[model samples]
Target: DQQVKQNSPSLSVQEGRISILNCDYTNSMFDYFLWYKKYPAEGPTFLISISSIKDKNEDGRFTVFLNKSAKHLSLHIVPSQPGDSAVYFCAASNQGGKLIFGQGTELSVKP
Candidate 1:
């Protein structure tokens, strides 16, 4: 069974609009959550993250929200730009830093 899932396989949005990606997890042992953005050939790069202690974390145009009670999380990108188009992955880590990743969500930001 997949411990983490991104129900939506892809998202399309206009530039300067908002893009929201959703993810869910079944493991309660996860204490840390992270979002990563990947390009065609390059490796996934860290975007934003939130510890179980916080409900939200933000940086620039990216924000990550965690709802522990529901075992859900989401990544929000405001003013999405063409350069923002990428595959985004949601990941969760246990205390030992072992991570579980959801299926990636391909984001398309059209001009």
Candidate 2:
């Protein structure tokens, strides 16, 4: 089954603190991974991505790590900001074009 699971429905962190989000998948064929950050009434924007070939990927304050063997992945946000408050979706696709996404993790940055 092509299922990406975000165990947590939501997360809250103080501003400037680190926020961690977890995700798991059942599909072994999933080789390419991506994280998308979305605000309300908008489409998901690509945050970071890692291929099955690489274990980690990072951009600015956002980082994503993948463990192929464990079928797990996580996203870490450093120095979380109030602007960062939004839904984060972890997506995976073996074919590289189409993606399967988790329900979502809503991140709230408290001031």
Candidate 3:
């Protein structure tokens, strides 16, 4: 069974708007959450991450939030630009560092 899931397969946002990507996990052992952005023909690069101890973490235009009780997490990109359009994958890992990834959400930022 898939431990991580991205309910929405895709999301569309206007440039300069906020883009929100969501993910849910069934494994309570997961204590770390990470978001990766992948462009076509390229490997996924780390975007942002959060620990279960913290509810939110922010970096420039990106933010990651974790809801430990709900076993849910989200990544937010503010003022999204065309360059931000990509496939985003959410991953979770426990102390062992074994990562479980969501299917990924393709975000389209329209200019």
Candidate 4:
């Protein structure tokens, strides 16, 4: 059973625009969060992350916000670039240290 879900299968944004990707989880036990970016034929690479204790975390042009009460999270990419066009996955883990992943949301950054 899928504990995590990404409602949107894809998103398109112009270069220099902001891209927002959303995810929701049914498992309240999820405490650690992570976002991974993947290029075609490449393995997913860690992008950004947040813990349940933190409401938000930011790095460079990327930001992730967690809503523990809502069991929701979102990733924001500022100035979305064509290079950023790829599949993005949302992952969560609890104290047991097993990761649960949501279906990836494909992001297209048009030049």
Candidate 2: tens digits of C-alpha lDDT, residues 1-111? 539999899999999999999999999999899899999999889889999998888899998999988999999999899999999999999794999999999999999
Report, for every candidate in turn, its global Cα lDDT versus the true structure.
0.96, 0.93, 0.95, 0.96
- Per-residue alpha-carbon lDDT of candidate 4 for residues 35-57, written as tens digits (9 for 90 to 100): 99999999999999999989999
> Total backbone clashes of model 2?
0
Encode model 1's per-residue lDDT on 28-54: one tens digit a residue.
989999999999999999999999999
Candidate 1 TM-score over all chains jointly: 0.98
TM-score of each: 0.98, 0.95, 0.98, 0.97
Clashes of each: 0, 0, 0, 0
Q: Which is better, 3 or 4, measured by lDDT?
A: 4
Q: What is candidate 2's TM-score against the reference?
A: 0.95
RMSD of each: 0.5, 1.2, 0.6, 0.7
lDDT of 3 by residue, 1-111 (tens): 999999999999999999999999999989899999999999999999998889999999999989988989999999899999999999999888888899999999999
Per TM-score, the best of the predicted structures is 1
Q: Using TM-score as the measure, what is the rank order of every candidate, best first?
A: 1, 3, 4, 2
Query: Which candidate, 1 or 2, has the higher lDDT?
Result: 1
